[model samples]
Target: MFFKEVVASLYAWDLLDENVDHALDVLQRETRTNSTYLVALMHDEKRPLTDFYYPHNPRRKVYWTEDSRAYWRPSPDGYERIKPRLSDSDELAGTDWMQVLIDASRARGMSVGAELSHTWIDKERTRTELADCVQRDVYGNPFDGQVCFNNPDVRAYAKALYVDLAANYDIDYVMTCVRGFNPGRGEGADTELGRLVGTTHGGCFCDSCQARAEAHGVDWAALTERLRWLADGYDRFNHKQNFELRLLLASTANITSLLVELPELYAFLKFRADSLTEFFAEVRTAVKDVSPRTDLRLNHYAGHPELMGLDLRSVAKQLDSIRSSDYAEQSGDPARMEWKRGYLHNIRRTVGLDMYFLSAVSPRPKATPELVEQGVRISAECGADALTIGHYDGSWLDCLRAVKSGLDKVGIEIRPDLPMWQRAAPALDGNPPHEIVPSSRS
Candidate 1:
């Protein structure tokens, strides 16, 4: 079965002979995979793929620091400082790895796309030692890093960097790697393990943001606090509880505020949304600038209300296409798969990112054909365009089987493209790289 376009989340930063050979073995063994793309979602200081991949490399680790050089986003100063650097120490086997993958796919009679990492702004970096990278809601609640896109500096820097990356790596498809701004889990966020609570991902309330809020005739801090309140409340409460408080967070909470304090929130959010709109526009243009033939794809990362501020439909009316992911993890329980539809539905409406459910990180090398059948049918209920079996670089028998079984059920072919990269194995505690750094709680 040939997929429209299959891809792999290549975590090959530490690819060794054994790993590469292992991936090659899988590449040799699996069948029906067509035109597998590479997921360059990497952001170690030594691994700045964006210099040759995406514009404005915000080297954002999952809830980590912004991944870019002298990058900028929204802050009271009107810009977040993100210095960019180049990682050109080592060379992979291919002359132009991205293009090589494209050529390889074409040789296999398949079209290819690259979900290259556009990750530049890491959400979780200690802005100041002992200072949390993110902030709490205005009223002091759940903390989530707000990806501030309004800063012209970040846009300028990202555009400049993207131009270089796209110019260098010409693949068939180009999509920015949307990442999590919040991490360490929220109080009531859904997790494979249990309840999650932390103040992560919310961003600065600087003078510039205040100015923007005032310009919009609003109290910037108040509005920001309101948004954080929503995130915190959601973190503190389960999905249902968050739903109950949404009205309060969005509007009712503002009812009692002094009119002077009211406009800032609206102003700040409006500025944020408009700024992102501008960035995306620039991203589309930059990609076109680099490789006119390349198609563009963007992500809505869960429900980004800020991005939705100006109506994502209107904001991104000009881009080629946008994509979203369910990013599902493998599970023993069928209900986990079934239960995910709710998450996707809300993301679709909230961000209006026109997303199609993409289930990845499945317990591959372990999934049964029956399990694949059930998951495939259930995931498709959300109007998924296609299914790609996520194959990590460890004990991947189940992932290979998942590809075959799910494709068989969906009447698609297995795309046997080479592993563009390798990723770490799923952690039992959902915490790989304990050496990366400890959470504030730790």
Candidate 2:
């Protein structure tokens, strides 16, 4: 099926009944140059905007601790459980958030899609033995509340959730986000101590990961001991010298000695990627089981797929599209723009020509019409099949109109005159004229 040349991502919470008409009108008015698709947030693994739509097996109730952590508590008695996280005044009860948003978007003749995240589980829930599938760090510490992809139960639960979403929602596509095991950015790695720990010891030595790595022929024990020795040395030095100087010395030693001497680190990284590949494969199977026609896409990071354990080429066959954040505001400098273009070209090379590539433009800090125009033009020039204007709630209508103007200049079609509702959709098999072509430089 042909992908929409322009798409918009809407937060499910923003799609209230009172403002549905106004939102549609804004989308219609802004997306004047092209027929658009809507990718809505459906099943949020973290703090959900709506009530849990899927039925729980044992019947769980959401609980909030004094520290503001949220978790699901087993409700065997089926009593009215308190949801402290949800304010009593927030009136979204009885609302089928997914169905309501899909119906509204389809009513406007826009193709609908949903986004899901797999890595995060509610923190409070992870604390419970029933839901303790959190990913472990190098030190065997669980990452905040994220579930380990290596856990069969977690994988089953995630697949079941995807299957449920596909079976229930009348949506055209699904976009999976954060489906890898990489630690969050602010996780200890950002701090001096954390950096030292990560550099010296290859982490995430959980039993499941160790078993998987061993299966892959990695010398898991030897690698772990080597990392531990390096970590211990760093720790010993950390207490003896100035912290900043010690960190610098440790980082230098880690780069110049540890990583170079240990070839297992490379194999370990590959193992991580392979694990994620297996997880995504199962997710693809689940999506196809419910409906073979439903497209599967990834909300990919801009680059560093290797760090995220994503092998785009191997996974491309299982996916229909890849939507990445362009964040064009960062493209103001010449070097940054060149890097962005190179990254886009690399994605085209990796995914081949068949899969659709969509670039998401952020209108943050500055949302001027000129910036929007530049973002659209850059994405098109960089060989994007479609460009999505992110976060409709905060975007200016004038800036959206500017996106249309930019696309118009690139000779892309804008289906503003098409009927708001249709009995039968047109054939989406053919490629449009503006379909992304591989850059000659690539």
Name the best candidate (by lDDT).
Answer: 2
How many Å off is the CA of 170 in candidate 2?
1.2
Clashing pairs in 2: 33-414, 34-414, 137-204, 138-203, 138-204
Identify the leading candidate in terms of TM-score. 2
lDDT of 2 at 209: 76
Candidate 1 TM-score, true structure as reference: 0.59
lDDT at position 66, candidate 2 = 25
User: What is residue 318's positional error in candidate 1, in angstroms?
Assistant: 5.1
lDDT of 2 by residue, 260-320 (tens): 5555554555566667666767777776767777767788863556545567776665577
Per-candidate TM vs. native? 0.59, 0.73
Tens-place lDDT per residue, model 1, 235-325, is: 5455654664554444443333522343433343345454445556666666675577665555444443332333355343434544444
Error of 1 at 308 (Å): 9.9
- Residue 139 CA error for candidate 2 (Å)? 1.1
